[model samples]
Target: MDLHEPVTPFAVLDADKVATNVARLRGRLAGTGVPLRLHVKTAKSVEVALMAFDGTPGPIAVSTLAEAEAFAAAGFTDIVYAVGIAPDKLTRVADLRERGVDLVVLLDSVAQASAAAKAAVPALIEIDSDGHRAGLAPDDPAVLEIAGILPEVRGVLTHAGRSYYAYTPEEKHRVAADEVAHAVRVAERLRAAGYAAPVVSIGSTPSGHTPVELTGVTEARIGNFVFLDLVMAGLGVCAVEDLALSVVATVIGHQRDKGWILTDGGWMATSQDRSTAQQKIDQGYGLVTDLDGVPYPDLLMSAASQEHGVLSVRPGSAAELPDLPVGARVRILPNHACATAAQHDRYHVIGTGSRTVRAVWPRVRGW
Candidate 1:
């Protein structure tokens, strides 16, 4: 089918670009000996995950239990439910484990540890490396406390959430190093305390791309690298051309007086994630591009309603608005790949530099 055959306001994924991205990261970590526990939260399709691991099921980290269950059904044996485990979710976790899946949960509290212990579920202690989100500090007494409560501690995990804001190369390297250091420290502490904490995991898209030495780290969990977005581009982690995912929307109308080209794709299509707002350049909603995925100079989705996207040239740019009339389709690059992709049910897959739709890959949705 033709790429434009699809109705406007749908997700389009470049298959070749996905392969290039997966290979690029795999190459980077090839010599490190620390395998990538590819996070399935971004591209929830089993096809994409298989592409990441070269057609074989490998270690994966999931943000939701539904993702865990979906991947488990796909024959993934080593899975990590990377979110903090809630006591009520133990039944579901246990069910997955009963299917011969080594599913590990993450937690930082003793109460959660107690519940996991009672359920005989393995768990990793979440370590806070940069104070970006929930996790115990490397030196926190709770690390050992939680380990003591759990029957068998799997290991330690930390995400460099702050690395997204590390715009410079030096800053990214530092954040990545710190992330591994913190996770290694906690794992060593657990081993010293007589707990067989074996796994040491640390990652974030930025950290994964940065040149950090993963000395004692066992694996790195990276999801967004599959579909590089404007946020990662803004952080210097990946170039705009490296982005593999985009929302295809058609031009419905225009406001000539204000130089606004309106599209049917709004915040709902691209997501209301103004993550680049904190960066040096604020991508209002998202960067607008032609169907070929070449971004027009200074063109961006300036404003968005539930179903309307207002496209205009960047404030101080000299580039003129392209002559996109009604019915002309355009692709809008996203700010956050995970959030934007969630707005769509499936991806209209295409090959590199091609306008034909190769396949339609469905996404695994819901909690």
Candidate 2:
């Protein structure tokens, strides 16, 4: 099928770009001796995960039990449910473990640890590396307190969530190093207290790409790297040309006097994520590109309705809006790949520098 055969507002993925992105990270970590526990929370597709792991199942981290269950059914044996485990979800985790899937859970509180311990599930302590979200501090007394409650302490995990704001390579490296140091410090603390806590995992797309010493880290969890978006591009973590995921939309109308080109793709299609707003150059909703994946100069999806995207030249730019007519096709590069991809059920796969659809990969949804 051709890339345009799919109806407007569908997701598209470049298989070659995905492979290159995977290789780039693998190459960066080649000497670090730490394996990548590929995070499926972004792509949420077994095919993408297999591609990240070079067509074989290896260790993976998931944000939901649905992802863990789906991957377990797909022959992924070693898995980590990286989200804070709810006591209610312990039964499902135990069920997966009974099926020979080493499904590890993550938690930061004694309450969660108690549930995990009673469920007999191996767990990782979540450390607050940058205070971007959940997790105990590296030196928090609760680290040992949680370790004392859990029977099987797998290790510690931290994400440099704030690393997304790192604008320069040096800043990204510093954040990545700090992320690793925090996780390793917590792991060392666990080990010193007589727990075998061996897994020291840390990652974010920025940290994963930045070359950092992984002396004591056991694994890195990366997901958004599989589909670099405008956010990553804005952060200097990747180039705009490296973005592999896009929304294929057809022009629905044009407001020539106002210099707005409307498309069938909107917030529902591209998602409501505005992560690039914090960056130096704010991509309102997304960047506009041609169907072949070449970006238009100064064009952006400036506004969107539920099913309509307004494309216009960037404010203050002298560039003219391209003469896109009704029914014309265009591709929209997303602000956040994970959020945009979540709005679609599957990907229309194309090769690098090509428009022909080679395959369609399905994405798993639900909690």
Count clashes in each candidate, considering only residues at least 3 apart in sequence or on different chains: 0, 0
lDDT of each: 0.92, 0.92
TM-score of 2: 0.98
Model 2 agreement with the true structure over 261-295: per-residue lDDT tens digits: 99999999999999888888999999999999999
In candidate 2 the C-alpha lDDT for residue 170 amounts to 82
In model 1, which regions exceed 4 Å deviation?
none
TM-score against native, each model: 0.99, 0.98
Worst 10 residues of 2 by lDDT: 164-173
